[model samples]
Target: MTNTTKTILGLIIAILVVWGIYSILQKSSEPMANEPIKIGFIGPLTGDMATYGETEKNTIEIALEEINQSGELKRKLEVIYEDGKCSGKDAVTAAQKLINIDKVHIILGGLCSTETLGVAPLVESNKVILFSSLSSNPSISQAGDYIFRNSPSDSEFGRADAEFIVSQGIKRVAIITENTDYSQGVREIMKNIFQEKNIDIVADEIFNSGTKDFRTYLTKIKSVNPEAIYINPGGSAAVAGLIPKQIGELGIKNVKIFGNFLLGDKEALSVGGQAMEGIIFSDSKDLTQLSGSLIEKYKSKFEKDPAHDALVAARYDSVYIIKDAIKSCGNDDSDCIKNYLYDMPEYSGMIGSYKFDLNGDLLSEEFVIHKKIVDGVPQVIE
Candidate 1:
């Protein structure tokens, strides 16, 4: 080989060596750009309950964005969402995938109480912390230690509703609930409370969770001629549509309607309209007052105002609580975070003051009674 060619070949080899070392150093010294603390969410992304799921997903996204912007945590927060379809089987499958495939240490969802209950055992056995934002069925908390809920249980809401009913002197009442754990639980609690208050239940009926035709049930309720009707339909959009339409068509003007928090939604307002004019409900917090700047931010991002979906506020607060717990625990260890959550005294959230009890349920004293306005907005009725 010529001397010049030999020199060029040697220089090329040296350059390649230098580049290889540089690449190694770059890869070693710099952390992966995509590294994130993963949290799993399981909800009904594609069913009658999809509205709730979408609200939750949006709230979490907003919370993460704010947290990341603030740079409050050492690790960037990332959420992985799975569609539970509000089904127990789907919830179990989603939970397993989140645990085994995604390797998520913490899960923040399963909107439906049935879904939450279905996944509770698996999550508990795996020692994974599952924080439910909206599943209000009491059995969820009874599932295990690893299962935690930030929202008030159906019992709480039912008691509040019953109190409202008693205050209004509603003696003769009717109940129509969807056939699901949440609706049934609320109905049972409210029934007990009403009985205790000496209120007479004139009509009691159950409808399928996603049923669109509640005419038969409404007709039955009308036939009973109860002074008030308590509709606990498990937040199903179809029921939301049917209830108001049927009630309006049935021309039940004087009858008062009591609803669960699940009925507090845009779709319900749009469909229920004049029929929902005087309907009263017990809710965790007044969304309009509870959500301040967060509501504005949500509106800007989603092009719509946040409605009565408690899951939105709950999910947002859950993220902040997780952040606070992480900060308090001083690490990302699951046990440490769990301990911190249980030990938390009082964390002011959008909803109200949040402090976890021994059972990891948030204790708060700010629930409100709201009555639907003629314009479809809910106004706090003292």
Candidate 2:
């Protein structure tokens, strides 16, 4: 009697185990009705450029809310954020995790050019879409078909900066470049333009990335006694800011200071303080009526203004841009998303109306000169 009972119980247990395995398989095979489409974000959440990352993060959150609320997609969107810390090595690690572990077909970051360039190869090889909201290194244009950026390239930025310098009759200039993809790209293009226009580059100095003390570079720049000094740094607005402040601390007078787009950043303005007064730099001409409205919206929603309105707006647009592509081609098709972006018509958004070229670079953008510390606030000088 005991053997018979034990055998019957064992058979029952086996059947229950098999049924449980079948049920698990069935559940795994069927997609959840409300499953989210996961994407990846690689940016510097804790670095000198952390402000930029933080701003983009907040902007994306706003975009997601708007998109999700509108009910434009079959599934909700979710992001897995990885801090690249504005470092290439860190970005590569983040990219690997996003591509392999998270299995995300789309990524929305690497805000710094260093981070974008770092992850470019991995994304390209793996066929993941890497859409950078703010990285502007010209090299990114050729990174891969799957790579794109909403920000204008430094190629355009360099040309605008160079032309502005020439127009101002600034014949003699000193150029300081922080050795990183973004800064180096701008330096190269600007130098070439300066050479073509017969402008004198009296002192060309290069510094390693993340070098906090720019006093040595400033001293050399002072010694050159150029009519102007162009401060280009790849990492933080702080680097761009500290350079001018140091120039002032060195008593370098009568020199017009110039910088890239970042020179107008709030962090730069705060760090440079009075030293940034009358300093001219290039910025997106797209920062007009539309951007003003977005700024107000951001202020109202977040209870604070974005650090860089144009950049934050572009980050916000990137989310929508990806959203449209995902809607058109579905979330899993990286190739379709790439094609959709490449052939995307001129998209008008908070930043501006623009299209992508074959290389995924913005087809058009305009630059305008800005002066800082005009009555204690930045002013559009041109």
The candidate that wins on TM-score is 2
Give the residue spans of candidate 2 off by over 4 A: 1-33, 210-215, 286-288, 365-369
- Model 2 residue 200 CA deviation (Å) reads 1.7
Candidate 2 — which pairs collide? none
- Residue-wise C-alpha lDDT for candidate 1, range 1-382, written one tens digit per residue: 9999999999999999999989976765554554777789998899777777888889999999999999887778889999999899999999999998777878988888888999989988888888988888977657888878888887788888888888888889999888888888988888898888899999999987557877888888899899988888775654764696689897876888888765666677777766667677767676546677777778889997654455677789899988887767655568888887888878777877778777777687755566665567777676
| Residue-by-residue lDDT tens digits, candidate 2, 1-382 | 6999999999999999999989977765565768888889999899677777888888888888888889999989888899999889999999998887677899998888889999998999999999997888898989888999878888888888888889889999999998878889999999999999999999999999778887888888888789989888776788878898889888999998888877887788888888888887788764656667767877898898777777777888789899999899866579999999999999987777888898988876564445655744767774
Task: Give residue 227's error in model 1 in angstroms.
Answer: 1.4
User: Distance (Å) between predicted and true CA of 72, model 2?
Assistant: 1.7
